[model samples]
Target: MNGNDQVSRCGYVAIVGRPNVGKSTLLNRILGQKISITSKKPQTTRHQVLGIHTEGATQAIYVDTPGIHLAQGDRNKAINRYMNDAATSALRDVDLVVFIVDRTKWTEEDELVFQRIEHLKVPVILALNKVDWLDDKAELLPFIQKLAARRDFAEVIPISAIQGDQVSVLEQAVAQRLPESIHYFPDDQVTDRSQRFLAAELVREKIMRSLGNELPYQTTVEIEQFKYQGKTLHIHALILVEREGQKKIIIGEKGERIRQIGRDARVDMQDAFESKVMLNLWVKVKRGWSDDDRALKSLGFDDLG
Candidate 1:
């Protein structure tokens, strides 16, 4: 068929992996924009973020899900369960699956992710990410082979989500496999999430980055106000923690840490929204919110299975 008469193709593609395997990074790189937040910490992503990438005659809707983790002991909470449910739920009805693994390393979590998608009817592409961090390039083949044997993957490709290495090839593989259908989103739309959700995620990302090892997983951000006034966007975010001690850690001495988070988040907000941003942050102690099912549902974690 001629280029003008080429059939249009669009489909949902789920990017699944263990925590910190660069799922979010790959989605952002593919979309050429930051719809999903990334950090050094695992489980930084909690929601199923849909990044829509539309090219000529193709629209690949990528679902960037939270890492599917094994909840055990202290880690087993309502929030953790919610995250697992969110990740698995994305697999249902997807046309394709991109299962990402970090470099040559495969942990039990990776096995868990593999088990989840092993029985899938759709094509699952095994994306070995973070090859840029590999010290020995010769190990690539063996590692790829090892993972390729685990399942009948549609394709096994090496990638560096951070550096954009071989990502376009991956995108091409995804686009070619998309089933013929109508585009679900506008050509200009990059993500299905609203600005309010992105804003809250950005704030949570800043807190996770700023605190480093001290960061509490129980912390969540809620946008109390998100609206545009004249040429500027105003955001009021409340940071909820499980304990008073965690609240203090986020606040820091003289409230410097929270202010820093606000400043950093506002910059990202401005860049994301393409407008001036006025971000206000406040930390509150919501005891057992993370473990409480009702509290989690109230905080927008109601999308669980």
Candidate 2:
């Protein structure tokens, strides 16, 4: 049938998993673009990123969420609560849920995610991510069978989000389940986020990748200026940390580390914006911002439930 004669299908699909389970990678692979940032650290994704994929008559809007983790004692910060809420809230009305798990390893966090979605009326596809990293291919079927017995999943598919193995099959499975409806985004559109948000995210991604375990979680990026002059995109990002020590760590000796971060971020911005980028970065101390509710709200963390 011609394009005009076929019916369009569109729906929201939520990708949920524990920290560092390749949820962002899967979304980027499915959409063939990067909307969600990734790092080796847990909780790298702290917000709900929407990636839109339109193919022929099917458009799947994917919500890539933060890793749902337990918070207690020192970990029970306002930001942690925000992250958990953001992750769970994405499940409210989604048409389908792609529950990703690290290959053959189910932790308490994975069980927590399952508990949250167990009662949902929508179809849940259990995606076994990182299958390419598995040493023994013989373990696949038994692991699949073990998880499949947890509940009645619509489909239990093994996929390697990083290697693009079975990713197309996963996308096809998602497309088949989408409801018949008009596309919410244009065929050319890929994400619901703006360039300003993406610019800040790219900077944050660099920080996450550059720093050690603890510091990246203590930092966030804010764009002070984003404008176009001639053929260049100029951006000024403010990196906020909770202490002077943290600021110094990000800045590094003789400002070399921060400069490297800027250089990396600028390249990504240029590629994403398709324009020359004049990027500037600065680090500041915002004490207790990560734990203070008012500070978090002021820093644009108030969108979650």
Write candidate 2's Cα lDDT for 228-296 as tens digits. 999988899999998888898899999999999999999989989999999999999888889999988
> What's model 1's TM-score?
0.97
RMSD of 2: 1.3
In model 1, which range of ten residues has the least summed lDDT? 1-10
Query: For this target, which candidate reaches the highest lDDT against the unseen true structure?
Result: 1
Pairs of residues at least 3 apart in sequence or in different chains that clash in candidate 2? none
| Each prediction's RMSD to truth | 1.4, 1.3
* lDDT on C-alpha atoms for all candidate structures: 0.92, 0.91
- 230 in model 2: Cα distance from truth in Å? 1.2
Collision count for each candidate, in order = 0, 0
* CA deviation > 4 Å runs, candidate 2: 1-4, 214-216
